[model samples]
Target: MGDIENIDNLLALEALLQVTFHNRSLLLRAITHHSCCSETALRDSYDTLEFLGDAIISAHVVEYIYRSFPNASEGDMTALKSEVVSRRVFALIGQQLGLFPFIRVDIANLRTFNERSRDSLCADVLEALVGAIHIDQGAEVARDFVARAILPMVEQVSVQADTNPKGRLQKIILQRTGSLPRYRVLEQSGRNNDRIFLVGVYDQETLLGLGKASSIKEAGRLAAREALETLQKQRGKASIIDVGDESQPQL
Candidate 1:
């Protein structure tokens, strides 16, 4: 980690993100990880910015979906929103922006950093960047950045909506049990910046399946998928009526 006064890095980042920062310090702060904050003498970390950014992204997404899909049901709108605001989606966009090279982290922390940590870091930095943009410019500019840089990913999600396990599971459970599926964060571990989430999906009072992943949303989706598969298997079994002739049904 170095000083935030590096003009070259600032210029490079501006070029990379296709957004100019009026305040370069916000840009630097956006890319900084919490692990490097104390060592770099930065009084502010990206956490606060990330929080703001998360809300900003969510609001924009909700508005976008609501306007774009006026006839869509609440469940459909929710499904689409989930795809857009997901941590996995954010991390993928971050990777496309080449954010990893620009992220500042302490060397000691680097040793323990795995794919999970990388995904979380990229996701956080992207959100923080959004926060930074909103602060330095305005909501319109931030919205433009999101629309230009990140919104295109929505196409992929739209195409792959059929493969969304959570949505599929929701439909199947609603049809079969006439009840909504429930998800709970069963456990969380690791540092705040790179926590592992364990989520469980329940059908009413019974625990149907469990899943673990880098983010709670992903973990919940996985759990729903597992539960869906389990329910499908249970449904696959032949009933007594199906196993024998209906004409000889008397016991």
Candidate 2:
């Protein structure tokens, strides 16, 4: 929101993104959170640009998956896309870009920010940066940015998605219940950086599993894995019970 005063911030950000901006103001706005905006009426924050960038990034990711995975089924491509294009993944990638120090937020909020809030902020800012690039340099440059920053993650995500417990659980639940399994945060503790997430997966009213990890997404994955294992055991027990039923009449 500052006028021509955040030049140093702009230069550092440009170096980080490796894309110089002609409209430095746009870049500045991209790093500026809504809390820093002094006026509600003025266009001063990354919120709108983040929205646009969400669509732009999704489009680019979808196109890339469609072309690169031509032999894959629709379900496969979708599963791959879901892993790589998620907010948690984006936040992880954004951290590697070293964008945190350049972001402008209210001092109070910044001080109190937890890992979840930090991840959300990083993801939103990355999207806003793409939106700013699309506006200042056009769609191709924006695509290039994503190619450099985001697409490299697809291979890693693909490997994980191949055996992704979360995805597997979703498929099973969707097939059996005609609805996806739900996850709930059970507990949290520790400081901002060291925070832990305890999550539980549920099938309607039944609790299938619980897991604890440093991130919500990872915790959810663990919970799903547990649920799958539990289901397998239950099936095994059912099979044993059926075999032990000697009350059945012989044929």
Candidate 3:
């Protein structure tokens, strides 16, 4: 997109974000990537803004969590912040905001990268925007933006605490069975830009379950979850069978 058109689109996005910046130039800089401008150019890029926004986002998220969950300890708040500020989470938020379509990247320079790789640009733009908002509007506006746009979507905190399958499975197997659960890389395939993996969960050489995902960590978690479910089922059935075995047999 042309410079004027890009500015117009950014203004429209600002409206959608419900933020009016006192310094419109900062907003423009936030959306403009280094790829959009050459090194010798007079105009500033989004990198500095992204760095500032990273700090702002983390602080706001931590403050919100602190107040929202007064009973939660510092460690719990730190874990929550890590998950919320992860690259995956930011990319997902950028996608939700439809920032990719509005980003201006030279097609010639980006022909080698896949869609997932290009998404990093969108994430950077998001951080830059946050930085711009914090600078122009202040911390309250930035906090409100995060609360409205990002906080509500982070509903998996409790689920994360309870169903940390990998940790729970490891502890259970080690305590009861006196052996740690093993993970095997069952398969790995996909394009160089985006790889997929399938992993299996084994308990003492017994293949208990399997799972597949776009990342090895995710695949391992899925396998552990499946193994946990399988073990629970076996325990339930054994309980039932044990009760039956205690009953008197009919002649």
Candidate 4:
């Protein structure tokens, strides 16, 4: 709710993060915002740590994706990374960890800002905390922090991917033929901002499915869903739909 400058506050934060800071000043600085600090005292802010934490989180995320998804392509890994390191994801993590209350901000500015702005601020503070942890301890400790706070979300991501039509189709195609399904835009029409895209999905030489949507991604997903349904009809018993009971959203 206020500046986390006191010993008790720092200790509580340490408990929350499950890491004991050798240099407590780093922890204090990580929770302080520049808006709340004077020019002369700006060094007390979390800015520097935020910068460092961005790199720290990114490196760990890339490593995590590479090792966890051994079969995933570079593009796939990158897509997962983008989702994991996204501001929205970080903001959700930050909120869950109660980082917002500890952040020291200019009350006037904070009051004027909207929910989106506050979420961005919370995400920044979360990154700064990661930076501080890295500086105060090391990569191993920072990794522990990430595992505790961020990696749990990886499971959720997996579940989302599992229920995704495109993800399901990719896994099925890859397992059945050891080749990924390809989606190509057959035609695009309408205005630039509100354009329509017709996409076709192929497995090797066969056109498995076709779909039309406003965006390339949506069209691809729809095509994948259609492909899955088609495959199910052809195979009868052995189909991707029978692979799991996970409910997929309609693309």
Which candidate has the highest TM-score of all? Answer: 3
Question: Each candidate's lDDT (Cα)?
Answer: 0.82, 0.86, 0.79, 0.82
Off by over 4 Å in 1: 1-5, 39-42, 162-164, 173-251
| Predicted candidate 4 versus true structure: per-residue lDDT over 9-119, tens digit per residue | 888888988999999878988988777785834588988889999889989888888888899888778778876887778989999999887777786744456565678
Q: How do the residues 166-235 of candidate 2 rate in per-residue lDDT, one tens digit apiece?
A: 8888889888899889999999997766789999999997899999988898899889989998988998
Clash pairs, candidate 4, are none
Q: Which scores better on TM-score, 2 or 3?
A: 3
lDDT value, candidate 2, whole model: 0.86
Q: List where candidate 3 sits over 4 angstroms from the true fold.
A: 38-43, 73-75, 159-164, 228-251
> What is the lDDT, from 0 to 100, of the residue 38 in candidate 4?
58
Candidate 4, superposed: residue stretches over 4 Å from native:
1-5, 162-251
| TM-score between model 2 and native | 0.73
Q: Report the lDDT of model 2 for residue 245.
A: 88
The window of 10 residues in a row where model 1 has the poorest summed lDDT is: 238-247
For TM-score, candidate 1 versus 2, the one ahead is: 2
